[model samples]
Each structure stands twice: as C-alpha cells, then as structure tokens.
Target: MFRTRSDKVSLVMGHVIVTRGIAELPAVFFTAIMEAVRRFDDFTEHNDPHGEHDFGALTVSGERIFWKIDYYKRGTEEGSPDPSNMVLTERVLTVMLAEEY
Candidate 1:
C-alpha cells in the first residue's frame, strides 16, 4: 500500500479536545516526536524496519503527552474514523495527556 501523509492531527483531552494540522506542527514539538520515534525504533523489540506506529507517550516541554495514530483500513464514511482508505489511508494522529482517554 502507498503511504499516506498526515494532513493533520486530532487532539483528545480529558476536559477538552483540539486539533493541530501538519502545517501547524511546531518544529520543536515535531523534533521531540521524531526523537522519541528514533529512540523507540532503536529499542530491541521495535527494531522492525517495516513496523507501523501504534501508540506513543513521552514528555516534551515538561508536559506528558500521548499519541496514537488511526489508520484508515477502509475509507472514511460520514466523517467518521480518524484515518479514513482501503487497506491504508491518511493516518490521523490523536494526541492527548497521559491521564486522558
């Protein structure tokens, strides 16, 4: 399947939720996420080159943040499903606090 780009990310929080598009991703924040991903990939159990990202949690800027990507195994219908395609679609990243769902 062809890889799809993350056009934006949805943020889910305990009290409130928000969103941040790819264009709005702060460079510093993006850097932090990349660092974490790199570290995760280096771990013995996550060494698979074709591994797909599922969940991630880390502290950046003194804030504990968690993230998960929803892959659209099937295309979006009625604006539901975070990531909406057949087999693979745009992956929507859901970011939130550690305590939030």
Candidate 2:
C-alpha cells in the first residue's frame, strides 16, 4: 500500500513500543482525498479527544478507511490542534483502516 511514497517512506524490520514521524507517504493520496471531497461532498475534518485533528473517513468496497492528522496547539501546549488552522505548532498525518487499531 505504501508503494507511492515518492521516495519518502522508510522501512524498518523491527518492532517498538512507540514511534513518531516514522512513516512517509505521497501527497497524491491527499489529492485523491480532495477529489473525493469534491465528488462526494464529504466533510473532511473533525474534532475529538484523541488528537485527531483533520479526519478523513471514506468507504471503499464496503471497507472503511481513514486519513487523519494530529497537531499540537501553538500557545496552551495542548495536543489535538485542528490541522486546517494555520497556527499549529506541529502536525502529523496518519492513514489507516477503521478497524486496524
């Protein structure tokens, strides 16, 4: 599934308890999502407790998939800043199936 990283992906043949920014993906996926938004008229973002800032949920062949981002709020030092906002202190994108976790 990660064949389209545009050479940004890193492969690791090991395990860890936690990791950050270890995955790199292509921007084309986002383009496709924007296309889907224009075509399907689906809302692309949501707010929640788990830091899921910009959330993209799509259904394909009866399977639900998601694309989302986590961000840090600039001032109060809080997590889960909305990715659409221009003032995020940090941002990270994530892609996964609904049931993967």
Candidate 3:
C-alpha cells in the first residue's frame, strides 16, 4: 500500500525506513531495490507460512534485500494493541540488506 498508494498509507500513518547498508548503495541500485520491493509478489508457504503479507525477500543488482512491516502504537515505541485498527496503529516498513538480518 505504501509504494503504490500514498493516500491510503497516510490513513494508517505509514512510514518507510531504510537500513544503513541499503542507504549507502548507489542511487541506481537503491532505486532498483525500491522498485523490486514494490513489485515483489513471490510469497509462498516457505516464506509466508503465517499468511501475513508483511515480509519479503528479493535480489537487486546481485544483492539480497529484505523488507518488513511492523505495527506500532502512534507516538510511542510500543507495539500496537490492534494493528487492524488504523486509528491507533502506525505501520513502519523497514528495508535492509539480507546480511543485516
């Protein structure tokens, strides 16, 4: 929702965070990684056993990367009591290199 639809994301207080390793990549590679993440849809039983579409792995420019979305309480560092309740939840999407896992 974050990559393709900003208006919807704003309703849930969505945020995107890139790790240090990913931030240091060249502009081309960084752009490629973001694009790859936006297009990622390779979920399977092995990687998505829980059926929560909040995590994914992909490769860009020969480098493996992972992205995950976590729910938190707005204006606090605690996890949200009800992620489904957009009124009280904030979504934080983190992107990082595989090695950083």
Candidate 4:
C-alpha cells in the first residue's frame, strides 16, 4: 500500500513494515530488498517457473500517514488451481513525498 501523509508514508504487510518519510533510507536497505527479490525469483524459477507474482497498494486513514500493501503469487496459466496462486508473498517498499510536511 502507498499512503501520503503530512510527513511520510507508511507501507505495511503481514509482519513486515517499512516507512518512507521526508528522509532518505539507508542504501543497505534498498540493496537488501533488491537482492532478496532477485534471490526469490531464482528460487521460484527452479521450484515453480510458471508462477507469477504481483504487488499492490491501498490507502487508509484519510489517505494520510497510512497505507497497505498486498503481495501474492499466482499460477502462470490463465486458469489454475494452485493454492500458491492465492498466497501473499511480501511487501516490497513504500514511497513518500520528499518535501512534504
């Protein structure tokens, strides 16, 4: 989810949460997320190459300082009965205005 706040944006998913405000995040954080995603893809390709993943954003709390994110995977096939297709994978990141109050 992506939320715009007076000072920052909050991104939440499951038990993992990340907040992006008017300040910059550590470079290591960005690097870690990218690396994890890349590794996940590698693993998934070996285990389930035909699986597809997606991420989405939602607004909450008057569209200020709060947002929700939903990540999940689905079968690559147009129609499949794989339960993994309905599972949430993870929340990647949240972005906020750099100059917002």
Candidate 5:
C-alpha cells in the first residue's frame, strides 16, 4: 500500500539516535535539525539512487548534518534480510553532525 520502502519505515522512525556531536548542539540548532529531518523530502537520483530514502544530509544553522536509517534483524545486530518486512526489521535512524562522520 505504500509508495516505497521508505513509507513503511515509520515503524522505525521512533527509534531515533542522535550522536554525541549532535547531542552537544545548542537547543535551537538541535530542534532545527530534528524538524528538518521530519520534513525532509528532497530525494533524487544522486542523493537516493536506491530509492530507499534511508539516508539524508542537510544543514541547520550553518552546521552540516547527516542522518541515516539502518535496518537490522529485530533485536539483533545483524543486517536484515528483508528490510521491507517491518515485523522482522528494526530500523535505527542515527543523526550526526557531518564532521563527526
């Protein structure tokens, strides 16, 4: 029913992880980054060739930021064999400052 695998990724969006670098940002800048991530929809062939919409980069308050969604076997560290199956996958979205990458 979803248009893409990304549409099915909502189940994992709740599991956000901000890296240490991002955690140290000022509250205003941090909030901006989070809001940007929520509103992001600039996918293109160059930035999202796979069309998974699992990764993105943006700038907030002049600071570069990067975010990525990774799929893993639910409750395990291994990569998921089928990322489309939400029941079998645990998606972790990690947000970090570009310099931290």
Candidate 6:
C-alpha cells in the first residue's frame, strides 16, 4: 500500500505504514481510514519519545495496525497562541478474505 497526505502539517499528517498482509492493501481499507478521520473533528497531540510531534498511522506485517491523531496548541514565545490543531485519527481495519486450509 501507499501513503497519502491531505494537509501541509509536516508532523501531523500522512504517516502510515503498511503491514499485516496483502489483503490489507486494498483501496477500501484506506478509504475506511479516511472516513474515520473525517468523523472526528478534533484530536489530541503529544510529544513522542523523540520530542517531536507524533501523528499518523502504522501497520505491521502479520500483526496489527495503529492510528495516531493529535491535537494541540502552539505559539511563539511572545505572539498570541494559535487555535487548536487536530491530527488525523489512525486505526486498523481488519478485512477478512477467504480462509486458507
């Protein structure tokens, strides 16, 4: 699968990894993710281990998928604070294919 970005937020947009299996590479799965993000209008932001803004989704092969939506406020040391920023909500959708024998 490929990655997509909708906004220019460098640290809070388009951060998804592909994994799980081949079946998860379909367009439907990606679309579902988009839908989920749309449903929510806000998100919470946090500093990751690296101290950088962490936002986006990640998937692992033969394991599971994860989504991270973040929301927070930032401003200059003297300037007024900006409005709340919302990151996209991320998650994994399990699409079952035919069972193998």
Stretches off by above 4 angstroms in model 2 are 1-41, 44-53, 73-88
| After superposition, candidate 4 runs with Cα above 4 Å error | 1-23, 42-50, 55-101
In terms of lDDT, the poorest run of 10 residues in model 3 is: 3-12
Better of 2 and 4 by TM-score: 2
Would you list the clashing residue pairs of candidate 3? none
Identify the superior model by TM-score, candidate 1 or candidate 6. Answer: 1
Task: Give the alpha carbon lDDT tens digit for every residue of 1-101 in model 2.
Answer: 11111335532221111112112224565445434522332443343444332455676444455655445565554873563454554444465546664
TM-score of 6: 0.24
lDDT of 1 by residue, 1-101 (tens): 12233435433311112244322458887667545543442223453334454566676666566666555434452333434333344445566655565
For candidate 1, what is the TM-score? 0.41
RMSD of 2: 11.8
lDDT of each: 0.47, 0.43, 0.85, 0.35, 0.82, 0.35
Instruction: Give stretches of model 1 more than 4 Å off.
Output: 1-50, 77-88
Which ten-residue region of model 4 has the weakest summed lDDT? 58-67
Q: Per-candidate TM vs. native? A: 0.41, 0.37, 0.86, 0.23, 0.87, 0.24
Candidate that beats the other on lDDT, 4 or 5, i.e. the better one: 5
> What lDDT does candidate 3 reach at residue 46?
96
Residue-level lDDT of model 6, residues 24-90, one tens digit each, is: 5667765664454334323335424443322433333332334443322322223223322232232
Candidate 3, 15-97: lDDT as tens digits = 89999999999999999998998777788999999877789999888999999998899889999999777789888999999
Clashing pairs in 2: none
Evaluate model 5: give its TM-score: 0.87
Which ranges of candidate 5 are over 4 A from the true structure? 1-14
